[model samples]
Target: MKLTPFLAAAAAILIASCGGSNDALDGPSGPAMGGGAGAAGSAGGGTGGAGGTSEPQDAGDSGEDGSNPDAPPGKTAEEACKTYVGAYCSQLGKCSPIYLQLIWKDAAACEASLVPVCVKSLGLPDTAKTPEFTASCGEAIGALDCSSFMGRKVPASCNPPTGPRADGAACGEDGQCANGYCATPLDQACGTCASRAAEDQDCDRDDDCAFGLICSKDNKCTPYVAKGGGCDENHPCEPGLSCKGAVGPTKGSCTDPAGPGQACDTQQIALPGCDLNAGYFCHLVTHVCQKMDLSQAGEACGVVNNGYSACTQSSMCKTNGGMSGTCLAPANSGDACDLVDGPYCVPPLRCVGNVCTELDPAGCK
Candidate 1:
């Protein structure tokens, strides 16, 4: 029987998609917080709004008693841009190229809303409110061009401290490279930055391949096997690609998998995968693509062979001592739980020592 459904979550996300999608830019690196230079900090934005960036010109020109002579000048848009953009840039060092794309989509709008708040808070320290700081920091933000981050492949100059490390330059992890990967390649040094390999190029790691391509068993970068092409454990098909037969490379070839609400058409349902991206699964008994169950919190779940059907994707089915279980949403930090492994805790919080707890702030990087 194919018992592969319970493989580690990291493997499911990392290795299965043919070479796998490049996560070069997914989201910003750290907490999306903006701080003021001095006395006037602004509230942070959520999904849509970035916050206010500027203030009225005459707002800061006086002390409390209707007109004291010791007030700072009103803040400028440029100053606001400096404070806001500087805080933003500080976080980009932690973002992957993929994350940069998300920020690019939202940063400008965030800036638009945030600039007014920054301007209003001009009583902030001279570090951000000064003309020199405004000029330089504003220029840096323009150079980043967060609006244009999409469609532009990350280049060598995108790294911190003078730019992304070049090939052969020292590095610790894949995210440090301008090309979005660092390759040590089989017992080699750990810090060398490696560029993505073009099609047909030789490489030892998947990240060495060009975005969207994969390094095959033959150690050459190749286009993702189209539907119906060969596949295996090492050379999985692209996202949405499915294979028939057993799980190994020699045992199967990529084929159209069953869709949600479609016929499974096979007795060995587990051997033929489903469109996991679409949240479909092969039902072993009924032999069809079953729409995943959407059990709510505390609802009964887990019947026979379908473990995942016990809950919605965002929730987990908490089994008791036996086969029966209840769907529960992920717990937040400090919440009590019945299971050790858990449906798991919600983000920023991790299931630690069987309890949900906040992760270190640096973990965001």
Candidate 2:
């Protein structure tokens, strides 16, 4: 079965809801420089970061160990992704966060799972057997981001050629509604344009409720509770609201999750309380919920008691430097990386790169 972009995007959302950061990304390290002739079947112009393979050069293209020892160590993951993924989708007549989210999953496995599917769907040679393909895949895959993809609109290319239906008109999908979403009234197969329902109005989906209101457990629109107001998983507050307390029948009150300089739970080791959606995370030293600063390649990271705050989420600060160190990309085979807590190498490739490589590996085993 051909997987649609919508399916890929939905999978990303599912993975995120299961309690994972959808915002995993390799910090931008700028595009690679250097050039040879363009290759055949290239997705975008054979630019520095826009990786693509040339015509079959040898048996390597037949699907064996997909490693391009010859391919220039072009741009890092972040650089290549910023160039191609967006361009590839736009060229295919679809460009939006929906597709972007699908391209960049919350973790390496999530992102890797989609690579083969994307290669096959796009008709590219199996990258595993082709060095050129591998080069393109690495960069394009590395630069995926969760924050950038949220709340993005479906591009006009993906929408029905005919404009959306008017309110009260029968609809089956979000694209069919004039407002870009369908609201099920009475649980019918054919929904209608989700007019924002006022307080106490019937509602089946959150979008059906008017601004400042949310759908309660009883499926009725209710005003969103402010700070200290009662709240739970089902009954959520406005954008910045965070329901505290333990998960169960009762959560807690809706309050400001965190502010720019306030303390927060970044690693989520504390209370699982901070709203990650708001970009709130406890900084290593301060443990405050503030936007993290991105550390570029070779920058100091992993300061003492800083909780790896100095490094970007994707890169790791070398372990040798106790208090401060350089932020470098995850090591490959026989390369150096942190073995202490959670090693950052892509799965199957163990933390100690020299120790293990996927021998007879299949799937994410």
Clashing pairs in 2: 66-128, 263-288, 264-288, 264-289, 266-282, 284-306
Off-target runs (Cα >4 Å) in candidate 2 are: 1-84, 87-120, 124-241, 247-250, 253-256, 262-280, 283-288, 296-300, 303-310, 317-328, 332-365
lDDT of 1 at 127: 11
The digit string of per-residue lDDT tens for model 2 on 1-365 reads: 01110111112111111111111111111000001011010111000011000000011131222233444455543333333333333321221221222122233433343233222212211111122333343332233332112211111122111214566765433333344334432112234544456677886433444333444567776654456776554554433345555257755665555555655543222332333332234455555544433354466554433433334323445546245666555444444433333234432233323231221111110
Best by TM-score: 1
Cα RMSD of predicted structure 2: 18.7
**Least accurate 10 contiguous residues by lDDT in model 2:** 48-57
Candidate 2 to truth, TM: 0.31
lDDT of each: 0.34, 0.31
Which 10 residues in a row give candidate 1 its minimum summed lDDT? 48-57
Number of residue pairs clashing in candidate 2, backbone atoms closer than 3 angstroms, sequence gap of 3 or more or interchain: 6
